[model samples]
Structure formats: structure tokens, C-alpha cells
Target: MPRTPRTFTVSDSIVVAASPEAVYGQVSRPALTGRWSPENLGATVHGTGGADRETYVGMVFDGHNKRGPARWSTRCTVTAADAGERFAFRVHAIGLRTPRLRGPIA
Candidate 1:
């Protein structure tokens, strides 16, 4: 007998019964994502708009992530932070211990 290769496509979704503010409160803070994510272990906000204050457009955050047994961090800058509307960031650098390199990450 011969073995057959396997291919799988996985997709998942969920419907949260919450208001926009509630959703935004959870999503805007990078430090809180670790509570729900598997690969992401959360982040540490740098200045001004730290996790304690409101999110802003120029806030910098160090994102910590892990996969299987490997761990790494990424230097990210918040590009958009519209309360209860939109939130986004850009990965500027990456490294194992610290993000020594700098630039727009692919």
C-alpha cells in the first residue's frame, strides 16, 4: 500500500455580540491581544499613547510573538487609530531579542 499526501484549508469566524466601543477597546490595545491569540503573546507600548491612555496615530509598540517553540519580536508603529472605527499598524523592524534592523517590513 502507498500513502497519500494531505492538504487542508482551514477557516474560522465568530460573531461577537458587542458594541463598536467594546470591540474597539479590545482591538486597539495591542497588549490585550495575548489574551485571545495563540501565536501573539501581546506587546509593550513605547511612549505617550501607552496602553493606559488612548491610542494615537504615531504610537510605537513592540509586538511579541511565538510559533511552536520559536519566539520573536517586531517593532511596529501605529498608522491609524480611529476610536471605535479603525486601527492599524506597520511592522518596521524585526529580530529575535530586539529589533535592531529598521525599515518597512514586507
Candidate 2:
């Protein structure tokens, strides 16, 4: 059987009554995401420097995530990081195993 490629996109936003610097301080730190994000369990910085290091463009790290009974890790790389402006990272699931779902069972 042939497999079809799949693409997924997720977006979220929150309004915080705080300075940009304060918000950036929390968002830029990968270790802190677990505290706020529901899906993200936690993250650890890779390749030395510091465990809770600030993310910069091109920085690589690993993220731990969980969804129901399934848990997985992802390799992430920071693509954009502008102080008090924007911080974005790309995630690639590691050792992911997709279950076969032929038709709508439900």
C-alpha cells in the first residue's frame, strides 16, 4: 500500500500583562516550557554551555513531550531568536512509530 504524506500545523497565543523582556525570559528558556505548555513535558539543552541556556538562532536541543499514553522526544533547532521580539524552533520527532489506521473506526 502507498502512504500519503501528512502535514500538521498548530498555533497558540496568550496575553500577558508583563514587559516584553520578562516574557522573552520565560519563552526563550526551553526548560521553562514544561511548566506552562500542556503537551510539552520538558526540554534539555544539548552540547554543553548550560542546561538552562537561552536559545539562539541555530541552537539545537531536545524536547520531551507527551500526549495521552504516548510519549516521545523531538530534536529541535532554533530558527529565529530576536530578544523581546520572536523565538521559534523547528521540531522533528525521533523514533516515531505511526499506527496503521485504515478507515474511520469511530
Candidate 3:
């Protein structure tokens, strides 16, 4: 069997009532990542520095809905960054989908 090639595009923006540095910190912060997305439990950094970049390991918490506490893991690549200005990452799952979730700080 062969899998069909699928492509999808999506974009979104958010305005944060904080400084750009604050916004950037929140984006890089592992604990704060979940606050942005409910599916995200938390993240773990595997390296150091922003120029070279690092690995962000995010976990998904399982809610007791129809299913029990199911834990899932996902990896994101910090593709783009500009200190306290902008940042971007690509979420890897079954397919390579670049989730360009970005916003400004207030």
C-alpha cells in the first residue's frame, strides 16, 4: 500500500499585552507553552543557545473524556527567531506540518 501525499496550509496571530522580550520568553518557556495550547502538556529543552537552536520536546496530557490518561510526545524545531521579535517552529507528527503560531507582545 502507498500513502497519498497530502498538503495543508494554516496561519494565525496573537497579540500579547507585554514586551517582545516577554513574549519571546513565554514562547521559549517550556511550562508556558501549554498555556498557549491545551494539547501541550509541557516541553523539555535538549540543548543550549538561540543562534544554534535546540530541541523542544512537548508532551500531551490525556483528559478523562472517552479515553483515559493518554500521554503523547511531539518534537518541534525552532526554525526561526529574532531575539525578542519573532519566532517559528515546525511540529513533527505523522506528517511534516509547519505550525507557524506567532504573536506580538503587549
* Model number with the top TM-score: 1
Model 3 residue pairs with clashes: 16-106, 17-106, 18-106
Worst 10 residues of 1 by lDDT: 5-14
lDDT of 1 by residue, 32-102 (tens): 87998898899999986567878888888899999998999999988898888778888889999797788
Off by over 4 Å in 3: 1-6, 48-70, 93-106
TM-score of 3: 0.53
> Against the unseen true structure, what C-alpha lDDT does each candidate score?
0.84, 0.73, 0.48
Distance from true location, Cα of 55 in model 2, Å: 1.7
lDDT of 2 by residue, 1-106 (tens): 9999666666888899998988988888887789888998777777777556667888876677789998766777788899999888876446333223233211
Can you write out model 3's per-residue Cα lDDT over 1-106, one digit (the tens) per residue? Answer: 9998666666788786899887777775544566776556555444454323432333221111111364444445555666686666655532112223332211
The 10-residue segment of model 2 with minimum total lDDT is 97-106
TM-score of each: 0.79, 0.75, 0.53
